[model samples]
Target: MGTGTDTPHGARAHARAQHGTRTATMPVVPATDWPDPPCAAGHLVWAETVAGGGYTHRPVARGTEIRLTDLQGDACAHLLLHSQARPWERLNVADTVKVQWNAYLRTGRLLLSDQGRVLATLVADTTDGRHDTLCGTSTLVRNTRRYGDGAAHSATPAGRELLTLAALKNGLDARDLPPSLSFFQGVEVRSGDHGDGDGDGTLHFTGSAGPGGSVTLRAEQDLTVLIANVPHPLDPRPAYTSTPLEVLAWRAAPTRPGDPLWDATPEGHRAFLNTAELLAAKDPS
Candidate 1:
């Protein structure tokens, strides 16, 4: 019933309204914008913060250092890795634990792929080596039971669902998803044979590394890294509580022949060799 003109009012009125809306829509930039500074000056390549219960995925080049920081200590950064060149060759948690002869991850440990190649190396850690590869990310059913709702857009989304979204964005699907590693949360193996005189151990969810804890890993191969910041499956808290996670990546040199981690173990040494062979054969740069 009104005029079909581009502006119902005059051009001046529309300009004034648009200016007011833009001013209100824009956020104010403060001096203390960055909570944490870069690890190294002038070398930061990428930085992002994944809100609690959020998911993110990115392709990282070889020789890059990726650091995941638990900004408030309650964040469980569920992580999955895939080789960029060969997506089929993804992280194998069981192989990583078996090949290293240690279940607990720490600095100098290597994250191995299913094809017996090194995907990433733990070059730095501030969380007392607290990490888990056994207990995978949270599921929709589990989160629904724990927090009432687990839809992708729900208040409490499951890590699996969130990661599925991330995977789909990267040209992958649910079938490509495997078990993931969780950083900032500690799961210990305790002897369940108390007074039973048996040799058995069970997983115990200890908790996260207090606030400000972080871990850094160096990519050994070009990797597609997927992360979901959510509550750990075994977290005992009754409330659905999680904190934000900060991710920072920078340019760095990959491991070389004289690097300590490369020769830290004969098994790891062989894994590094396998990684090098693949890179050399594929790129040879």
Candidate 2:
């Protein structure tokens, strides 16, 4: 009897020929058109691209392992988050800045924030110190004419404008809405001190209603109201008005089981969960 490691060369060769020559079959699973599982917290999900460039849903919490098989390919996704009635403050673009230096001590890198916070640390890279801020994907625009009535529009109105508008429609009086509305353009209202911290001001949005309805909006910090008078042209119906702030608040406000919209299909609720799970697994701390 010969020990496995002490077998004769010819015997070893024979064994290798018999065992190594055999090929194994890999199981093939067909792709399904179902949404991915949801994240653990139920706040995030994942989406995979389906036929026709559309996305199929998945939850991030499913613990799926995703790999970028094609090293040369790029992954593009949009991210939106809110925290305490404001945009999430953690994610910042300036954290990836690279600084360059001379050969002896080539590059220097530093992450920056608009308010001078460090969002990330550049551990290593081929490029020299100091990355291009203009070229980076993380960019924040505080005030741009593009967001104005003419050139651009946000799917959801927020920030100072929304705050001011909410105040006005809630009957805070133009005088009370002034401070918050002054910086914005195309807003009109009275000016006075209502003694409501920074003086309440009104913010307004003017535009012809689209297929949905009218387009006038007013808001204050805690309240927001939208007024649209454009009836469906064909129906010749009376102008309709809506206070989206109330709806948004209801959707975002604290409640049992949270807002259903957070889990709704069209909102890509599952995809967000997947993203969160992926991020957690990556442990990009």
Candidate 3:
């Protein structure tokens, strides 16, 4: 349709532009401070530094180990996980707490889904084993009230808002979000004479994890992981304070029947069985 002189030149230029933009890209920003011997053999799949009040999301294959490190003690990493194949199956915080028969988090603990399958397992914890599930991520309203500015680009962004954006990038919306788990921060429950039966207990924000604290979770299934590095909602500090967070993930094998974590508890053992059943169905070979 165009002039004969212009047609050939225009087609060549446009084809070059399209090819450059369509190429696949991967991010690799290694952290020199943290020495991971296991990662060297497994080969690092992802390495990133999420700044304070920032967020990130990605889909990983089964058997990937993700370690979140609070580069500085003040960072709080709010995390969420969902089954990539079946987005409806998501992290159920209540089931994770009830089925495990414990409200506290530590090594060998399983993160369960509402469907009774294990989504991930805490393989390593460098902190005192204190993490918070009762207090979810910060919100725009709360962050605005506390820090006077809660916009995502502002100095103090709400974790919920940040996660909402991250979800959008992954073809999800705000409604898809569930309760999140926070690392590098802790909460303590105190009950009165009522004996915690009436659900009357004080939830106290103990504090943040010390410098360079970290936790590693092994994915039991293909997963979509979302993380927001922000301050805890219950942090009493008037001024907004947060630090950088390090995210590292590498190839690894999921827990098996003989593994210590798999045989640690009856409830967890059953959950792992459920996960294995589902995974096997997806890939018979």
| Candidate 1 runs further than 4 Å off | 1-36, 192-199
Top model number, lDDT: 1
lDDT, candidate 2, 91-197, per-residue tens? 23322222111111111122222223222222222212111122111111322222222111233222333333333444443233211110001112323664644
TM-scores of the models, in the given order?
0.86, 0.19, 0.85
TM-score of predicted structure 1:
0.86
lDDT for 215 (candidate 3): 94
> Which of 1 and 3 is the better model by TM-score?
1
| Candidates sorted by lDDT, best first | 1, 3, 2
Off by over 4 Å in 2: 1-44, 48-85, 88-91, 98-133, 136-285
User: How many clashing residue pairs are found in candidate 3?
Assistant: 0
10 residues in a row with least lDDT, candidate 1: 23-32
Model 3 C-alpha lDDT per residue in residues 134-233, reported as the tens digit of each score: 8889998988888898888899999999999988988888998999999998987876664546346778788876888999999999999999989898
TM-score leader: 1
Model 3 regions lying over 4 Å from their true place: 1-38, 192-200
